[model samples]
Target: MRTTRNNNVAISCCSSSRNLVYKIKPLSHADSKRLLFKRIFGGEESCPSNLKEASTDILRKCGGLPLAINVTSSLLATRKTEQKWNEVRSRITSAEGIGSHMKHILSMSYFYLPLYLRSCLLYLTMFPEDYEVQKECLVHRWISEGFICGKDGEDLVELGDTYFYELVNRNLIEPVEVDYNGKASSCRVHDIMLDLLIDLSNGENFSSLLSNKANLARRIRRLSLMGNEDEGIIEQLDVSHARSLGVFRPTKQLPSLMKSDVLHVLDLSGCRGLENHHVRDIGRLVQLRYLNIHGTSINELPKKIGDLEYLETLYVDPGMIVLPESVSRLKRLTRLYVGTGTKLPDVIGNMENLQELRSINPFLQSTSFPEELGKLINLRKLGIHWRTSRSVGSSYKEKLVSSLCKLENFNLRTLNISFWLDEEDDFIRDFGFPRLNSVRTIRLWVGKFCWIAKCMLSHANLQDLGIMSGKIEQQDVETAGSISTLAEFGVFPACEGPVTITSRGFQQLQEFRFTWFNGLMFEAGAMPNLKELALTIPMYMLNYSESCFDFGIQHLASLATIHVQIDCRAVKAADVAALVCVLKSMAVAHPNRPALKMRTICEEDMLPDE
Candidate 1:
């Protein structure tokens, strides 16, 4: 049973089966001050000057407010005779800036935050700047790995939100200006706070000490050592310092540092000097969960590499690498990622617990798909990339599809099939994926355009469908019949796809996207239900090479969002005027779907759609 308290702001769950009861209370002024002081002073030696001043300034800033000044002063004296006036003044100025910027959040009452909550908040500092920290994504990651607590007693989403807000109130995270209903669209930690977090996480006891200073030992859990010319880690490590460690990087042969008792995640991608000795050293990190040796000089993983029984994720990037025959021994691995790897060992199908297989290389040359791949019923997301077209003759493509059909009953959500299929071959036959009814998103990269219209119509539950580069012919009249019903559709132009789409079958689509279509045009009244329309390539006039083709807004009456790409050099003001005029006419006619949001991306700003 769940009980609500504090006017429905707080919830407490009492469950006899789970033996759980939990309550979270708001912070009072005194409590806020106490926590601020505790956090600031505990790591004072390592904390930046601006942070210490920010902590002290919060106290005095609150004093100017109506409610906080009346609180008892017996807790800490107002040091009237401060000898370090210079430090105090400088800190006060910086703290004042922080206080000014976060006035609304700071005024909110604090809560009794748990240590784990603080740790989780601090860990975010390790990410690069201006990251969009999806609250749900973070919560799922934590819950999956046993980092969060109290899931049995309350809604995890609400608890996660509360902790996130608390962290924000404590001035640990700053939200980007964009918000959807007060939820952060993006977030970033102030650089000062990030430095503080890095210092704390990569403590002197745990971090791989690269310098003579042993102070950075225990604090580092995940180390990302980039670049080529780094000195050997043996001279840098102070092994007496480690407490918690996760990753070591730069793909180097750092055996002295690698021999640490705590290192868990290793990324040895792009290191040129790596050899068999490094692979042997990697086998010793039994607790290792992720190992990325992509782009390294090591061509083959040591046979003993499978000894790390706990490893769950591995990325061998751009190494043109191959695995030892013993890789089938890694029965616990859930994710196996190989980028630019030449061939996969035939024994990979022997591992039954494997859940994901991804390869990102255009140069992959494995001709036949392993029959054993069908054994991986637990696999959910599969991304295979291969260049060059071989029609349906490639048994590898058949095996890939056949393997997918075997996993028809699993809870598979995403399947990316990027294979070369010819126009005449039936890619989706009866032995086709019947169990893919659960699949909500599917991406197909058929080599020929004529295969698209037929391929788009087959999937049952596909809400999002992407078709990339094949010759698109307008011959199939019934093809448009399937597209009208799609909720979302994307097409990368082929040399011979539909030249003119004048059909009424596209009435039910909510989103319709086209990319690089040299000669494609939507017929009048084609997309009535379309809410969003994205055109990746500019519409140009056939006769005038320098002029742009214009689509008047009235043609897309139901579109609420329109995104188009235009060449700045080729576009004219009259073209924009024509577009606006078309939009104005559409707005005047359809009063309900007014204010069509239009955006144009030039070549300089355009990014390839994923």
Candidate 2:
């Protein structure tokens, strides 16, 4: 048992049973300084000149353990004076020691955290070991549990964002994914940090993990049931006062839902065997504010869902088809996320507090849907998937575009428009798209934008784009590259022609993909900031009698990864085999030694004509 003195935790991490050999390797000198200085001052160059000597001394004592480095650097980030830095360094008793010394440093970092931040950090213990925590989900849970309090005019959610960043900044958690907007989308607690937090959490009985461990907390405020083994331990405890509940795996034992009158969060996401009956009593918890059934086997939400009047966020799987019309009565609901083809009840006008309405395929919904959406002045982000077996006519498209313009006027930050399948109609150009001044990310999942692509370049705030054209011309390339803020761009050309890329455009592009490969060539100065490139084309393009195509990828100075896709339909087996070898050789010759990945696909058993 992993035990600590004072407030004892019930967590059983049987050290003797789980003993496994680990080859602990120390960081090299350069890497250690990079980690330390980057954490403290963004980079070594930015670190204070006067404190450089003290920083080095502290790093030496850390002895290359990342935990030690992070804690020491975080503790000294606010103290810029050399005296304070040296005094802190002098207090370090390790002197090149690594064992218990690392724990001592961690303890200081934990204690140094502001009281509120310490609670936030400790709350992370609710997540299972090695679980990747979503920032939005965690923050919302924190809000539901009353952990965040802001000034009278301040937004609590935004305040919660600051708290999230603080934990990340302090290195108590590691960022797993950072979006183009530069916010960490998800994070995970480090093992050392998790161990420490788990102990603290159990001591306070702030939350409990229902595991196979012998010692169990009878009363708990928050609880997580990770596996089936924990199911047997459920009836042994009481969760009447629990405010948050996270169910990880499928279980017949869903404890105390009827008794948890104050429960604010019910997350059955990824819980495989969850069925309709399991959540039938969910609405009884009138104080509930957040519900996440994503990836669960549940097919429908109980009609009692509307009884939970305080619910603010409702997330369900796209596969769950039945959306109770009574949901329109949820006046406090701010975010509603459903999958494609899941037509929301037309009562959207009732949700005045709605800030994000995900995923309405207007083609499948009533004509009044977009009109209802336009009135939502609070809607800041919209996710749309346009899907249809037959065309939905001009009226549908016109309403969508008009609503988008209205939403933009209300300051929509993100407009994510994806297609069930790529649409080729240049309909957007027929009825021009007016200025979208406030949208920061506009992803046109490549429906033959043709001439319309030029208009989007005018939006100075666009940082990422996925556009498709019937024919990618040099002029289009010039227009797109002119957007100084553009970082990720992908263009799928319907027609095959050489689109010679010149250095004149795309100065800020970091990731680029061009699906039309015929005559595609990269001039030496093209896409200087490009770190990844993906090229997709037919296998026949490489079957020239004289030679295979040369894409000129070597010109990309900063290229770090290369992905190629070959359409193998109706191609000779010999040709496919030869082109595979040729592409390998081409990747090997690149100066940057970028990692290469290739995909070959065919519907008819690969159509190997030979």
Candidate 3:
């Protein structure tokens, strides 16, 4: 016996002794309707009398296929009336095309969506199959493509998120990751849905997918080239009308963009064949708005890049790329992201529209660099990388702190600063961290934990805090726990020594993570509201006494999960087994023990002698 499984079909190929072949049948009509009704009404036992006839007809038209039934049900969930259901049934029965069995069912769902939603759904086809789309990236693209327009008092990012959730609610896309606040962070489309979208996109000339460049559309608006180099095919196409161009997995050098005068979004982020020469004429594409060359080989941005009057976003990978001073000419630029060591023109402060600037290496010889950064009044998110060697004199430190003080008046909400300083250097004393009202998220990678204590007291609205420091004292932990508004907190390995949490701390924290800590002692009633706890500690440091287990974890009444990673280089297998047994017993004894997940990582060979 042999079996084959395709998108909506499962077939069993078999040859009988009588020399006859037989094909397996699909789901029976009764079974299909049962599944469809369960999904449409959210597992309700029976359908209403008024909709019974409509449901039966809809299921019969779906042909007893699971994918068809689910897609049909998603569409029906929106249109509650019997008349609307009958209308959808009629359309599904009449849709014509290859693979009509599945295509028609999906097409009915697409056509029934609102006009604005249709464009948003079609835009998803540009991404590769099984790609996990980041919520921010997708929303930004939608806004750039003119698909998202906020109404009165609505922020554009919030509005875009609404559109994304709407698609998920309609069962068109699958949600991959949701944050602690129950907000989706990433999503993906089903393979069958992608196929239908590709077909519809090509048919309408709404977008083009170039694999070999055959059957090129006369006037394509959006073009996505996949697979290896096919310069011959790329050169033959007329790209003057293309508004967006993307090249994926290019094996050889890419063609120039001189002919594509009307391009708006150009993304060649991971193309290995990208070179400086290919983008020499990029300045001529004056209509460009979004450009991403993240993982390419280009070493320098042409001086003519300043010619793009309407460009809003510029993203490039980190390297020694020499950005021309003319970049300050882009008055409309909103987001500028570059590598760690990339040099910025002194006139960067002239780009008044900049909102997000990441990873500025502040080691330049110019003393006025920090002053220029202070002039970005519109900046919302700022990331700076500082090294001890750059701190030549007190003058640099004074200027840096002065610039940060000016930023406090702006609308900055997120701040990430990483420091590589010697053990003797005091981060908190040298840099007088300014207090900001709008800042809510703070991430620090410095040696001083004292600075964090000051920030916690300063930023009352702060919700997320991440600290990677050395020797976090008991007072520092107490300070973090005292923040009534904190929801998520993470302390990485750089932190040394044991930390104790007293009773009645962390009133609102839901998630807590501790890595490479010496020990953790929780007084009863500590972290009363924490839902998730993760600990990564070396096995040698754990004091597996009965009292330790008795007072440590059993007190976390609200914990739903305890994930423990134990490093087992210094302990024997028997000792590890004994520890696991004790932990299991403790969990079984607690009132609200929560689910326990533990893993052991062997750092040395511990096998018995042969």
Candidates' C-alpha lDDT: 0.52, 0.75, 0.74
lDDT of 1 at 231: 64
Q: Judged by lDDT against the true structure, how good is candidate 3?
A: 0.74
How far out, in Å, is residue 528 in model 1?
5.7
Off by over 4 Å in 2: 1-22, 27-57, 90-99, 152-159, 178-183, 212-215, 228-230, 235-237, 388-400, 420-429, 438-460, 467-485, 491-495, 514-520, 531-554, 557-610
lDDT of 3 at 217: 43
Clashing pairs in 3: 318-339
TM-score of the candidate numbered 2?
0.79
Clashes per model (N, Cα, C within 3 A): 34, 2, 1
TM-score for each predicted model, relative to the true structure:
0.60, 0.79, 0.80
Tens digit of lDDT per residue, candidate 1, span 534-584?
Answer: 666453422323223343344665666555554433555555456556644
Best lDDT goes to which candidate? 2
Per-residue CA lDDT of candidate 3, range 19-116, in tens?
Answer: 33344465798788778778877554766678888887777777767777777888988777888887886776644533566887887789888888
The Cα RMSD of model 3 versus the native structure comes to 5.7
